[model samples]
Every structure is written in structure tokens, then in C-alpha cells.
Target: MTTTIRNGIMIAAMALALGACASKGAPTSQFDFGPLPAAAPASASSIGAIIVADVTGPAALDTERMHYRLLYSDARQSRPYAYNQWTSTPSQLLTQRIKASLAQAGVKVLSTTDAAASTTVLRMEVEDFAQNFDSATASSGVVRLRASVFRMHRLVDQKTFSRSVPAPSADAAGGARALADASDAVAADLLGWLAALPPSKE
Candidate 1:
């Protein structure tokens, strides 16, 4: 009877230890931003009389793409385990989306490379592109964008936009989905803003 009691105590202690270890292994409830989505399709807008130069931005050396780095307001590691997971290189993805939106609005866009062409130049500077977490729920992803438009070396307009969108609830897919959703929101906001701007004249 004494031997049976001793064995029971030993088994209970081992089970407690194992349970503690499992709890420790779980990932902390921290926010993890993921990569942006592939660029969307261009607009059918007549690319009117306006010619937009190729968008420019800070180099994303990590990805060799122009639009890279999910700029954080504070100094925090972007993701815990994944490097470059949330970074998006600025490419035709954003430009195409903007183009498509403008096309829909019947705005003309010109090419930036053609300096000799007599057309109003539209230059866009993407200041901040990132996904933000809600203070109440860190897991809930929100999209934020800050950008400005320039015409003829003058700042025509600037704005900051944000939106709350559904993110993946599962751990396996959460980060990626957050990134894509954020990008989509940014693109949509940018297009809407551009559509509202007064047409530039040479």
C-alpha cells in the first residue's frame, strides 16, 4: 500500500511539470505583422492627359524591391520569429492599384520617365505603409497609410488614412492575411484620395 501511494505522487508531480512546460512553449500574445499582398490590377482610366512618373521610395534592401519595410512608429521588432515576413517592396503593385482607381475616375496619368513630354507630372511619395494593432486587441490588425502628392515640384495634397479590416484568426494564417488586407486598404484609400484631388494643369 505504501508503494502504490509513492508511485501516485511521482506521477502527479511529473504531470504538473509537463503541463508547465507546455504552457511555456506557447507563443506570447504579441502582434506580428506579415508581408503585403501582390499588386492589384491597373485601372482602365484613359491615363488621361496627366503623366505619372514611376513611384519612388526608400530602398527596401532586404527584398531588392522599392516598397519594402513595414514602417513602425516605434522601435519594435516587426515579427518575433519571421524576418522580412511583413515587408513589401514598393513595385507596380501599388502603382497599378492607383492607376486602376484613377482610370475608373476618368483621370489621366502620364509617365514620369518622359520628361520631354508636355504634360502635368504627378509624383507620389509614400511616407508610411504599415499595419497597426488595436490597443484593446493586439491580434486585431488595422491598416494605416500616409502619403503625399506632388505636381511640378509643389506639394498639392497630403493625407493619412486608416481602416480596420478582418484579419485571419488562426495563427497559421494570421500574419500573411493581415499584411495583404492592410495593403488592400492602403491602395483603396490612396485611390479614393487621388480621385478627389483637383486635376493638375501644365
Candidate 2:
């Protein structure tokens, strides 16, 4: 009986030791929090006769400083995710991104200081820049953006674009992860649209 009790204790101790070694650290999902997605190519051809003014913003909503929340199944219930607020103006950052995308599309960006010299001004007015938590059960987040485009001082186009990006809704452990994912989605769509615009003439 004594021998059996001693062996039992020894086996228990060994099991505990093995469990400690096998323990994985905090539960972290293998999720990617990378830059935004890229936009599709625009159908418009390069208009060489016009000088494209770089994309300008603050034209709409200030998303950089906006706080984001995820609403699950019910509209009344929501989970607060990471804050999208930015110290800098959202328009300034957006303009820079737009300029880069235009450059990549072979568009010549006219100087902002020379507004009159620009053959056509690319004005983007942001309307709604906010993240909406549409469904909670599916672990999904939606980003909505409303913008207006101007050409020759006239409203040429206006529309709202919304994207449903995946969010990690496991728990608070993955709140930042989910928000980051949503943010990237928004940025990617915005860049893709900006990139598709036709370049101005040299």
C-alpha cells in the first residue's frame, strides 16, 4: 500500500511537470494586421490634356480621430474596438496617400499652390468616414466612406463605398487585432479608388 501511494504521488508530479512544459503562452490567434488592401485598376484612360491636381481631403469626415466599435447581431449592443483617431488631420494623410497612388498611375500632380494653373482640380470631399459594427455573430466589421469628386469646379461624381472586413471577435484579447484589420481594409479601398483615377496631362 505504501509503495503504491508513493508511486501515485510521483506520477502526479511528473504529470504536472509535463503539463507546465506543454503550456502555450497567452492565446493569440495567427492573424495578420497589415496595411490596407490595394484598389482595382480604374477604367478611365489617361487624359493628357489636363493637369491633375493631387487628391485633397478633410473634404469629408475625420476618421483618423474617430473611435470605432463593433456591433454584433443587435444594433443596440456593440463592442468598442480600437480608436481610429489620429493626431494629424485625416485629409492631410489621405492627400499624401492619394498623391502617391496617382504618381504610380503615371499622373502628373499639379502644385497645390497653383490652383488656377491646374487644368482640372481633383477635389474629394469626404462625407462619412466611420466604421460600423454591423453583425456581431459573424465577427465582421464594415467600413463606410462617402465621397464627392469635382472636375472643373463641378460635381462630376459622388458615391458611397462600404467594405466588410473580417474582425477577430473572440474577445478583448483580439480587439486591437480586429480594429487593425478593419482599418487596413478602409485604407486599401480608398487607395484603390484614388489610384484608378486618370492622370492629368504633363
Score each candidate by Cα lDDT.
0.48, 0.45
Candidate 2 matches the true fold with a TM-score of 0.48
Q: Which portions of model 2 show Cα errors greater than 4 Å?
A: 1-66, 73-87, 134-141, 168-202
- Cα lDDT tens digits, model 2, 70-153, are 343234432222322343444554455545545544555665576666555555544433344443233444445555545567
Question: Residue by residue across 80-147, what tens digits does model 1's lDDT show?
Answer: 22222323344334565555545555565556666556345555555444334332123344445456
> What TM-score fits each model?
0.51, 0.48
* Model 1 bad stretches (over 4 Å): 1-47, 53-75, 80-92, 104-106, 116-119, 127-142, 170-172
Global Cα lDDT for candidate 2: 0.45
The 10-residue segment with the lowest total lDDT in model 1: 64-73
Give each model's clash number: 16, 11
Candidate 1 vs. true structure, TM-score: 0.51
The numbered model that scores best in TM-score is 1
Error of 1 at 56 (Å): 5.0
Top candidate on lDDT is 1
